[model samples]
Target: MGASGPAVLIAGPTASGKTALAVGLAAALGGEVINADSMQVYRELSILTARPTAAEMGGVPHHLFGHVAAGELYTVARWLADAEAALADVRARGRRPILVGGTGLYFSALVRGFSTVPAVPDAVRARWRERGAEIGPAGLHAILAERDPAMAARLRPTDPQRLLRALEVLEATGRSLADWQQETTRPLLGAGAWSGIVLTPDRTALRARIARRFAAMAAAGGLEEAARLDALGLDPVLPSMRAIGVPEMIAAARGDRSADDAVAAAITATRQYAKRQETWFRNQFSDWFRVDPLAGEGAALATALGHFGAGAGGAAG
Candidate 1:
């Protein structure tokens, strides 16, 4: 990434104002923001993903936000590739790069290196897809349990995609997915090249914020956005289709659920997702700087700047 200063990483649970903090940091440091969130990658899911609006971006350059189509498949490998290019470009332009998101895996891959799992052949993948469709996710997971018990035990029975992937990898290479994950390469963001922080708000306050923010999203044409995405007839297996609010909104749009009920379900789902994210950050990023949002953004900004050192306030691009 050239001879640039250390990059900044801002991670937190959903609805914890990660984007706002990212923008503020970028403004303070003359940095460009790069998205590390999975949901924010899809172009059709701005409202549901809570992606930053232009006004909220506040003139700082933002990359890898809403760049992928809903129907496209976006894997972590692809994200790493895109992120590496973005980081290099930002550094080459003499601007600090600030990566922000709730996706723990993205940060993990960036800082701790990504596993080089071999690609399953298309024929094998298609065969598994057919078998999964015929037997259902539970049945496929049962088969996975028989073939690769260690991998199967790690996956939920209801998660057909992972179950199928594990099954295909086992059949194709005779090795479990877990086995492949152990052999990882060098991290993209080497030591001394980056700084990271996790924002943790009070659980009660964060829950309240999640509920309120989701309600605001619904009121701000989130349902319409969901409906438009649904109309595209994308496969349910696509990562974009699995966005938190999309399924509930789709049910409401199809008359299978009331709009109010759908909104409630979506909010509950978001809260649950946020809780999982919080736990992940607690366990996985315990070493990074942790800020309590209850302490206010001023305090959080101070901590981030302190961690980033003298280059925290660089010239704007």
Candidate 2:
């Protein structure tokens, strides 16, 4: 909370203590915490998503957590609009807006603005899907390299979804995804109006924390939550259904796998997801403030406060 009114963004990999740090900062700076994590939006997923407990919020106001139904599709565009409104409301009340989460795309959309690419035609999409099914992702990626080298270079050959998207965008609009991205619209937080910090903790310690957190989730009725969500018969492709632990837990709940095996698989998947998040922040947010959680939580918050020029304050509303 710079006197000039800059929102604070706390981003990092999962199990890196981002939630604790964000809540502490919000309380100290008279700010409200806004969810930037895409997974945390689904109303049905509190435990598996690692959403903050009521007690853990520490009396600070929080927005956008567990607000969307698991059956609905929540996209980045919708999140940006919601976040803009949240920031406006928070600022109007004379409190800082602290956007915190592990999702890089949300932060990127906020700071760099959204790409206004046209929707791919359903026929074009279907064609690409059929091509992908016939030729496989690697082969499609090769075609993408020829049509959109810049986008292809950034995407993994094994990532069929992105590969298809890139190819479809090129075919439909005659523009690469990267090209569209370069022509961004107005960012929600304009230049110098926001500060961001990405927590960089030791990989080993983060993995261990992920394991412990998953175990805690199991003990905290995560299995029951998964059972309830699975019973809804939501589309497996939906973000909520693919949440880190939901699929594995659902498998166990359905007797497709043992509970112990599901837990282990979920823990492993979480670690893998954390690793991807870490890499993304490292690559995309190299200029943002970076602090090691192992160094200490207070130190990390102090660094953020220093960056934002926020003074000590009363409890957040």
Candidate 3:
């Protein structure tokens, strides 16, 4: 394997078989897997987040999975820094780095650079968090609408975390988050440094897969994971808590909702999230090679390997 050769990026929506494809490519190419999923970073909810199991890892070394505590706020900047280190480490060891996950922002930052948003002071963050708790997501969004309508219009009112972030940036830097986003640093992987693929499965088939996978998760300790996370009593607005299924599962575990109802809600949420992920990939990664992993992991792997073997350049499907 060439140490300086292009790193392979496998991105897809949930339940698209990204893990299997990545592990297969790693095994075939003398590579290692680096996580790019935001939810999979938490050490506390592996089952709920569907962090790949030990058996699923297929003896390939995986980096940055389940490494952070549930209570901490894990930012894109933090993930970018960790991914940079992981990439460098894998390359230094003469192994290919295969970054696989559904998080489009992570891939975008690595490939197209990230804006350096000024850090919020602890006091300023606390003040906004307090306001959020009192007024809720809609309230925070309304405040942002008043202060920075451009950023607010770009964000969903239901997303309290991002709304809070926008407010904090305005409070701390006296500038809108939109203004800060225009000042991006150099990309971690510039053109020709990495080859990427987006796994785009058929929507109907993907929805079925999402349903089946979540049902399997429910039967396989997902409730237990959610219960444990709830026991930690973390803030509801934290990213870990806001993971697709955690809140529903926690409700189920606490007897606030029946198990079946919780599972149904989670499945629905997961499908919705998958749709958003697909849209993001389609729009943002238009240049990357595309593969439908629903065709079978072997076929997907073969297609990706062929792309890589062909110098892994240009857009292809």
Residue-wise lDDT of candidate 1 within 39-155, one digit each (tens)? 999999999899999999999999999999999878889999999999988998989899999999999999889988788898998898788879988999889888888999999
Top model number, lDDT: 3
Query: Which 10 successive residues of model 3 have the least lDDT summed?
Result: 308-317
Pick by TM-score: which candidate is best?
A: 3
Which digits, one per residue and each the tens of the lDDT, describe model 2 over residues 1-317? 34525787888999898888888788887889999999999999999999999999988999999999999878788899899888888888889888999999999988888987898898998798788878988999899888778899999897776787788889999878898888887878777677778899988888889999999999899999999999998756467887888989999889999889999999999998998998899899888877776676487767666755644221110
- Please list the residue runs of candidate 2 whose C-alpha ends up more than 4 Å from where it truly belongs after superposition: 1-4, 120-153, 157-164, 167-175, 306-317
> Model 1 off-target regions past 4 Å?
1-4, 309-317
Q: Cα lDDT of all candidates, in order?
A: 0.86, 0.85, 0.91
In candidate 3, what are the lDDT values of residues 117-207, reduced to their tens digit?
9789999999999999999999998989998999999999999999999999999999999999999999898776788899999999999
Per-model TM-score, in order, reads 0.93, 0.85, 0.97
The TM-score of candidate 1 is 0.93
Superior candidate under TM-score, 1 versus 3:
3
Measured with C-alpha atoms, the lDDT of residue 289 in candidate 3 is 86
| TM-score of structure candidate 2 | 0.85
